[model samples]
Target: MYGINSLIKSGSLEAAYPLHSGTYKWTVSGPLSDRQIYYKICLKITNYEMPRTEMEFDSSYIYKCYILDCINHFGSLMFFGFIMGRALDHPGVVISNPVSEAFYRNCAGLSCTFEMAVLQLTIWFVRSCFKMFTKLIIPYLNVKKRQKQHDSKFPNQKLRQWESDYLLNKSERYRIAHEYLDTVAEYGYVTFFISSFPLAPLCGFLTNIMHLRIDAYKSITLYRRPNAKKVPKLICFTKLLQATTYFGILTNAAMIAFNSDLVPKEIYRMYYNASLEGISHQQFSKIPTSTVYSFYKYKANEETCYYNQIRDDNQNKTLLYWWILAIRFAVLLGIEHIVFLVQGFVAYMIPDVPYSVQEQIAHQKKIQSDRRETEFSFNINRKKSVRETERFVLIK
Candidate 1:
C-alpha cells in the first residue's frame, strides 16, 4: 500500500488545468483511475447476464447456497474469539509497556489515569488508520492481480468475461460485504478495548469518525455494488459479546494485577515480592480500611471518590479486589444455574398430548414393531426356499 495520503482530493482543484484533459469525468475521477475508468471497462465486458432487477441466490434445498451464508454466520464466532485471544495475550502498547524512568516520564508505568487513557486512545486511533488503509488498498491490488491472470488465460477478457454467468442461478450480487468483516472486527476491538482500557468506548467516539469516513470512501470507489441483504442482528457476534463479558472481567483483573499499581505497595509486595510474612484472608480483612488516595495534583471543585469508606469485611477500598473476584465467580455460577433452571421450566411447560393421542401413538409404535418382526421372518423363510430350489435345479 502507498503508506499515507497527506494530499487532499477536493472538487475545487478541477480548474487548475495542469495537464488536465478538458473532460469533467477526469477532473471528478481519482488520481488512480483504477476505480473509475478501469472498473467501467471491466464492467462492460463482464460475463454477467443482463437483469434490470436484483435477485437472491438460490436458497432451495437442491443446491443449498444459503448453507454457505449460515456457515459464515457461525464462523464469525470463532473468528472473534481468535482475534480477542491474539490481541489480549500480547504486551499492549499503552499500559503494558514497561517504563524505564519514574519521574522522567509524564505518566506512570501503569495507572487508570487520564494520561494512560489518552495513550490507549491514541494507539487505537493509529491502528484504526492502518486497518482502514489496508482494507481500502489490498483488495483492489488482489483484484488487479486476478484480472491479469484471467487476461493471460483468455486473451481479451476481464473478470466480467472470466465466467459465463454467476456461480449461482442468480446475480453474483450476493458477494461478501465489508459489513460482516467490520462487525466481527469491531466485536473483538470493543472487548479488548474494554478489557484493557475502560475509557475505550469513549475513545471510540474519535476513531469511529476516521473509520466511518474511510469505509464510506472505499465503498463508493474500490468495491463493487453488492446485493444488499437486511440483517437484523449478527447472531454469532451477539453470542460472542456474551462470552466476552466474562472474558473482559478476567482481562481487567489480569491488567490490574500484573500491570497496574492499583493495589497498595504493602499488599502488592505480600503477593509478588515473595515475602515470607505469610498473610491470611482474616488478617487482610481486619487490616483496618485505609483512605483512598489520589496522586493527581489537580482536581475539579466537584471532586468525589468512587467508593465509600468500607465498614464491612469484604468492602476493602480496592473494591476489595478479592471480593470482586469472588463476586464475579458467584455471578457466573448463578447465571449458569438460572439458565439450566429456565430450560427445565420451559420443558415442563410444553403441552402434553391428550390421553387418547398418547395411547394411539403407543399402539401405532407397537404395530410398526410387529410388522417389522413379521417382515424379517418372511425374509428368512423366502431366502431358504430360494436356496433349496436353486440346489434342486443344479442337481437336475
Candidate 2:
C-alpha cells in the first residue's frame, strides 16, 4: 500500500537508504557496521566497525538499519495495543493468558481478553480516521488543481497537466501515500486483535496439557523404572500443533501482503482528487468494489496456472478453473468458520475436553464402588449359609 517514498518518510529501515542496483549504502550512523562495502547485505545489529574485508564492506549498513527499524516498529505497535486494549469490548476477540498478575489486572494486557477489547477500540478509531480522511481531507486535496507536467521526452499520448502535477507535489503525494499506509496499519492492527480470539483457549489447553505431561513424566521417572527409553507419542502431537500454527501464520502474512499490493494506484489518485474537488458522495459510492476482487482473482489465477503447468492437455483448462473456484470457496468457507468460531459456535461445540474426561473418570469410580458393595453383600450371605449348613450337619 505504501511506495518507497512513504516507507522512507515513515522511518522504515528497509527504505532508509537509496538502492544502487542490488547494493545499499549508508553513510549515516545508527545500527551499522564496517565503513567498507560487501557483496551481500547481511541484516544484523552491531556497533559500527571499520571494514577489514571486501565481503564485510559489501554487506552494507542498510541491512542492520532495516532490522532495527522493524524491531522498533513492532515494539511501538505492541505498546499501542497495550494502551488501547483497555478501551473496548471486542465481542468475538479473546485473550488467553497474562504473563504477569499486574498485566492481568491492568485491563490492557496483551492476553486475549485485553487484546480483544483493544481490537474493538482500534476498529472504531479506524472507522473514524477513514471518515475524516475521505469526507474532510480528501476534498481539501482536490482544491488546488495544479497543472500537471507531461515530459516531452516520453510523450506518445496527451496527458492531463493537472493530474500529473497533483501527484508530483511532495507534500500532497505524501499525504495521499501516508493515508494509504495509515489505513493499512490501523486496519491491520484491528484485524490482528480480532484474529487473536482463538489464542486464549488454545493456550490454556496447551498449558494445562504441558503441566500434566511434566507431572506424568516425573512420576514415571520416580516410580516406574520400565519404559524409560520409549518416547511419548504425545510429543509428536505438540510438534504437529507447532507446524500448523507456523504454516497458518505464513499463509496469512502472504495473503495480507498480496492484498495490500493489489490495491490500485488509480484508487489512491481518485481519493486524493475527489477530496480536493468535493466529489459528491453519491458519485463516490459508484466506485466499483468488483475491481478489487478482479485484480485479486487475476493474480490468484496466475498461481493456479503455475500449479496446472504439468497437467494433462485434456483437462488442464477445466481443471485450472475448477481449482481456482475451489480455492476461492475454501477461502470463503474458512473465513465463515472463523467468524462462527469467534461468535462461539465452534468453541461451544468443543467445550473443554479435559473437564469432561475428569467427569467420566469420577463417574467410573462411583460405578466401581457400587459393584464392590454388591459383591461384599453376596459374600456375607454365602458365609452365613455355609455356617448354617455346618451347624445342621453337626445336629444330624
Candidate 3:
C-alpha cells in the first residue's frame, strides 16, 4: 500500500483505491441492507475512509481539494503583499521628503493590495466558470459522438441510454505534496508586509470567503467524482504557518522603522520638541537647479527641490543623518523585542490543549482500561467453568 501510494505520488501510477459505485440514487432509494447503511454512517463519522459511492466520493474529494486550494490562496496573498512592497520601492515613485514619502508609499500600498485582492478573486472565479463550461459541454459532445458511432454500427437497433455519471468528464487530479506551497508563500506575504498595508487582513478575509463558495460549487457540480483518500494531520503546514508568523513580526518591525516616518517623527518630537507638520514645512533645505535642455528635445527651467535627507556643502551626510540612522536601528530592535515578548507571554498563558479536552481524553482512557479488565475476568471464569464440567463428566 505504501509503495502504491508512493507510486501514485510520483505519477508512476494514476490511482489505487476502492472504487465508488457510479451513482448516489441508492442513498434516496434506501441502502441494499442494514449493513450498507451502517458502513455509510461509519464512513461519515470516522472520516477514515471515503464512501464507495460517486456522489459521496466526489463531495469528499471536492471538499479536500477546496481546503488545499484555500491554503494555497492565502500563501499567495502573503507573498503578493511582500512583493508589492519591494516592487513599489523604485526611485521613480518615491517622494523626496521623508514624511511625504511614507504617506505616498502607504497610499500606493493600500491601492495595490486592494487591486491584488480583486485580481485574485477574479482569476479564481473565471477559472471556475471555464471549468464548469468544459465539464458540462465536453461530456455532451462525447455523448453525441458516441451516439453517432452507435447509429452507424447498429442502424436497426435502438440506442441505449447512458447514465449521467458515465457521461460526465473525469475530475482533474492535483498533487498533494505541492498543495500547501502556495499557502506558505501567501502567509509569508501577509504577515511579512502587513505593516505596509493594514487593510491586508480584511482583503484576505473577503477573498477567502468568496473563494470558499466558488470552490465548493466547482467541486460538487462542475468536476467529476474523484478518488477520495484520507488526509493526515498537516504538521508541515502548521510549522510553516508558525515560521511565517514569527518572521513576519520581524519584517513588520523593520518596515515600521525603515519604510515609514514613525521612528523619525518620534525622535524629532523627543529631541526638538517640534510637530511633524511644522518640521515638514521648516526643517528641510531646498537645492536650486540650473536650467538645462530636456532629453525630450525641449528646454526647461529647473526649480529648487526639497529633500528629507540632510547633507553638507560638500554633499557629505551630516551628523543628523547618522544619528537618525542609528536611532532607526534601535527602534527596529526595540519593536521586535517588545512584540516577541508579548507573543511569548501569550503563548505561555494559553496552553495548546484545552483543559476540557485533556479531561475528556483521560476519561476515555479510564473507560478503555475498565472494559479490558472486565473482558479479562470474564475469559478466566469461562475457562474455569469448562474445566469443572470436564471433571464432572470424568467422575460420572
In terms of TM-score, the best-performing candidate is 3
Q: List, residue by residue over 125-217, the lDDT tens digit for candidate 2.
A: 444444455534444454333321334444566557544534332332123223333333333333343333434344334434554554354
lDDT of 3 by residue, 315-384 (tens): 3567887888898899889999999999999999998999999999999999999999999999999999
Q: What order do candidates take by lDDT, descending?
A: 3, 1, 2
RMSD of each: 19.6, 31.7, 18.9
Q: TM-score per candidate, in order?
A: 0.31, 0.21, 0.54
User: Model 2, poorest ten-residue lDDT window?
Assistant: 15-24
Error of 3 at 332 (Å): 2.0
Residue-level lDDT tens digits of model 1 in 277-367: 3322212222121232222332322232221112244442444555544554555466456655675797587645666898999999999
2 against 3, candidate with superior TM-score: 3
Candidate 1: global Cα-lDDT?
0.41
**Number of the predicted model whose lDDT against the real structure is largest:** 3
lDDT of 3 at 299: 24
Q: Compute the lDDT of residue 229 as modeled in candidate 2.
A: 35
**Better model by lDDT: candidate 1 vs candidate 2:** 1
